[model samples]
Target: MYSGLMSTPERLIESTRELLWERGYVGTSPKAIQQHAGAGQGSMYHHFTGKPDLALAAIRRTAEQMRATAEAVLGGTGPAYARIEAYVLRERDVLKGCPVGRLTMDPDVIADDELRAPVTETLDWLRERLAAIVEEGCAQGEFTPGLDPQQVASTVVATVQGGYVLARSAGSPAAFDTAVRGLLALLAAARTPASAPAAS
Candidate 1:
């Protein structure tokens, strides 16, 4: 799934990332990675110490990509609620599920501290970033006072991850859309009235 121009190491990482997302850690074998990357076993070994090392690189790459994508929307100019909406409604492969979230379900990945670190860190960063936006929203009079930013952020993350599970189970994106719609509705309900004071 890579071009000839890509370096062997780059190809290996990219291939592993896709395989891990699709098949989880247990299913992704070194042979499969080499074959997918069109690299020889020698090339794979030359770049990485072993599967764990290669998997960590792939996981880190995926996590970095996820954060970059989220930051693009969350960091954009707009009301906090609007930015959150953009994040929740952002296009995704609902059926394939979250790349990082899937790792949390993989036994091998979770069992390995090094492999799991990126996944855990990525999710934690997401919650914190979202919590910051929520706190900003409250400050800007966009959301009602007394809303806990951290709680709200966790709910948002839960909804998206849960939505992916629901969508995958139903074999339809409708489940995901419904979950997002419900989240938006709740967020809308939490908005402060136009006449309300910012501090109120």
Candidate 2:
């Protein structure tokens, strides 16, 4: 029953990714995926061993795409602080929340190691990448000394994830904007150096 630009396997993966994003692992079903992909049960079974197997494939693909997107901004040319700021200020789907992070809230997915590995690894990679940048900024005096890179990285991640929650709760992006703005102000203030008095 699969006939489209994408092959049966590709359609299954792509459909699973969207369904997982829109409806977490627990909510997504094999029938729903088959329907979304316009594939029949036989086509789905031919491509994947089962729902979990297909879901893992979808989760991995989503995580990879997510990482690539983050790397585009974080790895761009600029001062470390600038890179971090750009990442923080990067445009996002405020209400939809993070794909990987959202998976963490899914009890079924989190309970299954195979399903959770990609999500956990992706987030860890992001945190470590951010920590590396923060450490570089501190070394370059872009930030005040004694600031912990890991702590700052974790805070940045938390702020973004928390912003999504806040935005969703309020039914608007205002809360998200407010959190980001406040964080940026703090970061800016932290980087400001105290000036010496003019010569008498």
Number of the top-ranking candidate, with TM-score as the measure:
1
Query: All candidates' lDDT scores?
Result: 0.94, 0.88
Q: What lDDT score is found at residue 83 in candidate 2?
A: 88
lDDT of 1 by residue, 1-200 (tens): 67889999999999999999989998999999999999999989999999999999999999999999999999987888889999999999999999999999999999999999999999999999999999998998888889999999999999999999999999999999999999988988898888233663
lDDT of 2 by residue, 1-200 (tens): 44566698999998999999898887899999999998899999997999999999999999999999999999976778788889878999888888888899999999999899999999999999999998988887878888899998998899988998899999898899899888877776667364212348
Instruction: Give the clashing residue pairs of candidate 2, or none.
Output: none
Q: How far is 160's C-alpha from truth in model 1 (Å)?
A: 0.1
